[model samples]
Structure formats: C-alpha cells, structure tokens
Target: MLLAALFLLSACKTEPANQGFCGIIPKRLEAAMSYGTSLYLGSMPDQEFLREDQGRSLRQIPPLEVREDPMAVQAVTRGRCAFSIFEESFASEQKELQGLKSAQLLYGYPDSVVFRMYVNPAALRGEEARTRTLDFLDTLWSDEFQSKLEFYGLKPVPEGLRTQVRNDLPGFLTTASESE
Candidate 1:
C-alpha cells in the first residue's frame, strides 16, 4: 500500500521535458495556472519565434498563465512569470510605470509586430459600406495618422518600405472593392 501510494504521487508530479527557457512550461516556470488564461498567441511573431528559433511548440510547453501586455510586464517584475514577450517601447514604458529597476532585453525577432486593418468583404455588403471601409483604410495610411503612430507607441515602417507598400495598395484596394 505504501509503495502504491508513492507511485501515484510521483506520477502526479509535473516534470520538465527539457532544460532552459524553451523547455519552460507552466509547471517548470512555477507560475500559477489559475492566474490567467492560456497564452493565445494566434499568428503573433512570438509564436513563430518559439517554433522556429526555439524549437518549441506552444502546444508542447504552454505557459501556465497569459496576462494582458501590461500585466505581463508586471508579472515579470513581480516574479510571477519566468519571462514574457513585449514590444521594446511598451516594455520600457511599463517598467517605468511599475518602478522596476530594469528589464533585460531578450532575443528580438527579425520581424516586428505589425498593426494592420482588415475589413471583411461580407461586412461591406453595400456600396456605402465598401466606400467607408476604403476611406478608413486610406486614412490609416495617410501622413496624419502615420505621424501619430509614435505617440501611440508604434513605429511606422521606413520610407522605402512605405513606398513599396503604397505601390501594392492599389491592387489590394481593387481586389477588396471587387469582393462580393
């Protein structure tokens, strides 16, 4: 009976699959699973970084808890999480707000987290709707909005990249307009 009970207890204990950050699942990180929801990284650059660069899939090593961006910074500061991904500017801002002494820079992904606006064709069923959506998209690319990006803690793509994007815009807009 004693041996059987010990075996059952050992089986219930969580174990790390491997060593280091990539191997750190909720159990390994010592984070409370009840604190937040599962990390929902749908198509984010952080997801790709874990997959390609770290050789780990979120499925195999899910975080115990995933908080909102600002809360994530606080979690790290408070030692609730082993580490969390953040935009450099946003992390700095949060660190200052939380009075953290410092935030160490982790690996930076080659691609940046981008902000994009997508309007569903189904949502634009009428001509007026289509026109309004197009105008909204155009306004997003306008110099006025571009200038305000930094104020909102966003950085605009470089001028060369912006020119390339502008060149591609006409065809994209035409396709969106033609969509039923």
Candidate 2:
C-alpha cells in the first residue's frame, strides 16, 4: 500500500507536457510557463538601439507608419534573423526548438506574438512532427511574420539591443512577471 501511494504521489508531481518557455519546456515546466506569457505581454523597447543607429529614433516615428513602411519591413526581417542566430547560439543551454508559433491577444503588439515553442526529446517521435514544426517556424520568419510584428508596436530588434535582451531575458522576465 505504501509503495502504491508513493508511486501515485510521484506521478502527480510530474510536469505537464505542454509547459515552459516558448522554445524549450523544462522538467519544472510550469514554473517557466509564465515566462513565455510574460515575454509576449511585456513592454519591450519599441526599437532597441534606435538612437545609436545613424541618429534614427524609433520613438519619433509614428507607430502606424512603422507598420506600413518598406524600410521597417526590412528592419524587422533583419531583427528576426538576428533573433534566430541568438536562439541557435543558446540552443544547447536552452531546450530543443519545437517550432515558431503565434498566440493572439487583443492588447499585444501585432495582435499576436510569435513564439518558438521547444519540444522535449520525449515528445519527438516521427518525421511528420519534425516537418510540421519546421514549416511553422519558416512561416513565422517570413515577410508575413514581419508584418505581424509591425502591426503590434514591436519593431525588429537591433543587433546591439538583441544582444542586451538575450543577456537579460531572465531579469526581464522576473521584473515583468513581478509587475503583473
């Protein structure tokens, strides 16, 4: 009876399959689940390092125009590229990439935020799963994705700012979560 009770308790303590950061789910996935939501809802600088780049000021630009301009599209594409590289650099340290997906929110930028959900090795099984995941990620990085980001207040991450945010994700998540 005691052994059976112990087994039940351990099973109850197991983490859910669908929890954790957008890119990687942890063993304690629930503790980190809020982090992913926070990343989507938190207020990131509209333009990172805008002031340093040729005196361009993201703050000065109207949000509507930012959403519509070709240059802005290019900038966002660059930012996404940089974000991908950054994600890869930290791949071993973080969880495996599940694929990029978006969640819709009325108040968030672009009306939706793109997320790269990570998959556990336990979850990876067949070729179909892998193919679908890759396709989703590709869509998320396409021009359509850039348009979505622009529709929200977010612009492409500047290289310098991207580095800063990558370095500071933990602290940023903490602060953002606390405020909520």
The Cα local distance difference test for each model comes to 0.32, 0.26
Candidate 1 segments whose C-alpha is farther than 4 A from its true place: 1-111, 164-180
Q: Give each model a TM-score.
A: 0.32, 0.26
The best candidate by lDDT is: 1
User: Per-residue CA lDDT of candidate 1, range 125-149, in tens?
Assistant: 2344334333433344545445444
Total clashes in model 2, counting residue pairs 3 or more apart in sequence or in different chains: 5
Q: Count the backbone clashes (under 3 Å) in each candidate.
A: 0, 5
Colliding residue pairs in candidate 2: 22-116, 22-117, 23-118, 109-152, 110-152
